[model samples]
Target: MGLLVFGGACLQGVGGLGFSMFCAPIALLLFPELVPGPLLALGCPLALLAGLREFKAIEWGTAGYTLVGRALGAALATAVLQVLSGPTLSVVFALLILGGVALSVQGWVVRVTPAASSAAGVASGLMGTITSAGAPPLAIALQDLQPAPLRATLGCVFFIGSVMSLLALAAAGKTDAHNLLIGVLLLPWMAAGFFASGPLARRMSRTGVRRVLLTLATFSALAVLAQGLLHSQA
Candidate 1:
């Protein structure tokens, strides 16, 4: 597991999405029992820290508008999933991600107007709750903003939302020692990636970034598909 996390760090060093896009799938392979629930819960702290680190860069009007609907959507997903069987939920979210990928390919960009942002917040919350895979829409929406605010706002929102998610998971009694260790172990990786972000972001071309993101997303999705096909713990 530690070795897998080290791999995660290298991927993260390349781009910001590796924690979820790379680490999560590999972790899923090694620890299916932990994936959609407990392990996902532990990682919320890293997500929270990510956002909080860029708190100053958040646009109040935008974040405030977005969070309202996001909270609502998160609440909705939580309420729904509390009763659903695990397999059912997995299939549902897999379909949704397939849809998102399709949307991405179809030139259907998510606009970031006040109304759209709020709507996307709800989508983010729901999608995040469903799969812990919520960023494509928000990323596309914020792509046009200045890079600093764009990244900072994302970090802040992910952090804040993830804190709420962790609290929810804890209340549900899903945590365990292994996941705790996983989150702690990821600390150094997250720090290194965050520190290196300055130069890496500067050096990365947008086209290159998008290509990397797409490739990693495909790999992650394929990992999930493989798990489903092989009747692994999905």
Candidate 2:
């Protein structure tokens, strides 16, 4: 688990949105308790570090709009948890992410306008709340940005979104002491990955970063899909 967290953090450091994408699937399969809550907890500081690394490049306006939508989405997801099974929602959202990825590959440009950012935030909040892998939507929405700004913006958005999701999960009684403890334990690994990412992030071009973002997004959706299927079968 430490190795896994470190690897995911490294990816996120480079791509601005990969920690959950890389870790959530395996965590769900093995450490079921280290998800939506624990992982979200870990994301808070990881995101903060990334945001601070490129603070000057952050798109503050986009972050603001995304946060507003994230709040609403988190609320709705909390309510949905009362009615839906986690595996069921996971399957549904995974398909949605795959669909979004498909459209993006087909030359569909998701402009990072206020409305689009908010929409992405909604999807991100919903997915992040349930699956702990919400970066795909926002990453897709902001793919057109340059590497530094993209990373900075995503970092800011994710830090706040993770906090909101944590609160919502806590209110829904999904988070507990065990999850928090696991998150705390994983911090050192995450930090190692974050620091290691510096050199890689510096070398990546805008195009390279976009490719990494899309590829990771697709992988995350597939991982979630596999997890959902396994859970349903189990």
Give TM-scores for every candidate, taking all chains together and pairing residue i with residue i.
Answer: 0.71, 0.87
**Which predicted model would earn the best TM-score?**
2
Model 2: residues >4 Å from true position, as ranges? 78-89, 169-178, 230-234
Candidate that would win on lDDT? 2
Lowest lDDT 10-mer window, candidate 1?
Answer: 8-17
lDDT for 204 in candidate 2 is 98
lDDT of 2 by residue, 100-124 (tens): 7888889886878999989988888
What CA RMSD would you report for each candidate? 4.1, 2.5
**Cα misplacement distance, residue 12 of candidate 2 (Å):** 0.7
